[model samples]
Target: MYQQNGEEIFVIDGHVHLWDATEENIDHRGGEEFIQCFYDYHTTFTPEDRQWDLDEYRKYGPDRMVDDLFATAAADMAIFQPTYLTDFYTEGFNTTEQNAELAAEYPERFVLNGTFDPRDGDEGLEYLDELHDKYDIPGVKLYTAEWRGDSKGWRLDDEEAFEFLEKCLELGIENIHAHKGPTIRPLNRDAFDVGDIDDAASSFPELNFIVEHVGLPRLDDFCWIGTQESNVYGGLAVAAPFAQNRPGKFSEILSELLWWLGEDRVLFGSDYAIWNPDWLVEEVLEAELTQEHRAEYGVEWDVETKKKVMGENIADLYDIDIEAKRETFRNDDISQEFGLEDHYASGDPAPADD
Candidate 1:
């Protein structure tokens, strides 16, 4: 799980979340939007300690999970989203307030990515403007896996959504995190197949949408989408299946992805808070976990490609200025900039002298 033991290499964790009732922005709200309606929230495969209930979730007390996420030094930067919109929060809730609060509390540890729900119409755009204009959120996350494709016979690239896409383009922001193409049977829903990427990328050349995960079962087609469009991109954030399915073939597929999307285009995401850090990072590091992959997957893990997938790609894509931004955050010095040191365990939180 520790990628490096000494060096303070900057890391950018692409996906993570923060929710505390005590916090200013994450407080209760009433709205008729997807994010808002899930107020009575609880994770599936419920924890053994107690049942899952959004109403009762806070009653257990604000968990230390988000703090753990912030305290961990391995993740130098994290862009997280709420687990979902529930009754506790509103659909119109923009990350601006959350990031502003986080930036004030633990600025260096947190980053912002705006949410877009087409169902809310102009209210969504107004919230997005507040996030971008006031909070400086660099990218947007569209949850097609959950919020979208609800109407009868609606395609992923519907006209209304495309208009929202134009609003994003006008805003000069398109680092979109789209949960595309999960297997239908897996979620047991009318799944949006892999071909959806092709349609979106073809129609919108101005947007920069990074299809999170490899789109499972439709990896080849998704890769093709990354191949054919300059605006299209892909990340191996949830690439564990690819590794377990054909561990030997990881290099081949990853290398092919490198060839198609170029190294900088492929991103890295932990999707943590929901998933374990050790497990997620290891999953991400799976494909290139061995020496044999230099030829098969190109370069090695912890080298340039890892940098690209994990941090560099997104930084460049989003034009993020970490150092400049860090000055304004609350805990720029609580942990080592980056390294394997037990920043939390030690009193000084310093790397070892020897």
Candidate 2:
């Protein structure tokens, strides 16, 4: 329900999660660590809801979670980069055949991203090459915090993750998204305070790394970091549930990031499976985007800037060519299964709801 200069506008959240780890699908492997990511992420999402035991996931609706993400991202369509955790995987957060299946099954809409953890060692590098050369993923995702006791959260300065970024730069994949874990403790509270990986960025000048979540007190620092590093960016997501209960608390971060980093380096994200899209979208729609500096970014207004933060910029970064992809998707059979024709097939939170 957003429009700009009479041009209807919506969002394409760059980040989202979808995992139905029930019994029926535990063996399904529709998503790998992506499954663990959801259950571990939501304290209340439940052992039953989080269990990757196939039979149970189907009961909750396996198709619902992922379908809802696509339905919400772009009303017409969406593009996604799957998230992962490395602890369970023997070889690291390897992109499973399930991920490839999703990407292949919905080529125009899904973009697969693989995770590289230092724990995997040199084998991780070899796996990365497969993602780069064989699979053609646009970026690498890593979480720099102790989530679910994952020691893989080692800082990029630790040399392993840093070396991984250097290789990412060499491979021509400039974008990297890091989840500094939760702002809450026991998981990765301090990791969020650990600001910009300057040493790594300085080493790999060509790489662009985006850190999601302001992570408590480091909000302002994160803004400055994004401003300083041409490759550094910040995104907003799962912070939704928090905002929903207390509204303006998050608006402070939204306004500050916009004030400090400007919208160019700011991106949109919905931590699906953890929080609903409706949670943030409602707040985002209500949050002020207008300002005298609107012209500074070359857009006619702030709404257009939002569009860039949400989808356009990401599409451009991956060289996704959404328009072209849209055209291709239109004639293909897959679009019918995933888009407008069946948009309401799965239940998605209404955009206006909290």
RMSD of each: 7.4, 7.4
Question: Measured by C-alpha RMSD in angstroms, how accurate is candidate 2?
Answer: 7.4
Report the number of the highest-TM-score candidate. Answer: 2
For residue 74, what is the lDDT in candidate 2?
39
Model 1 TM? 0.68
Candidate 2 segments whose C-alpha is farther than 4 A from its true place:
1-5, 20-62, 71-83, 86-97, 146-152, 183-189, 215-217, 240-245, 278-283, 289-301, 325-335, 338-354
**Candidate 2 residue 226 C-alpha distance from true site, Å:** 1.7
lDDT scores in order: 0.55, 0.55
lDDT of 1 by residue, 75-156 (tens): 5667765334433344223334554565545555566677666666788778777777876666777666443234222334
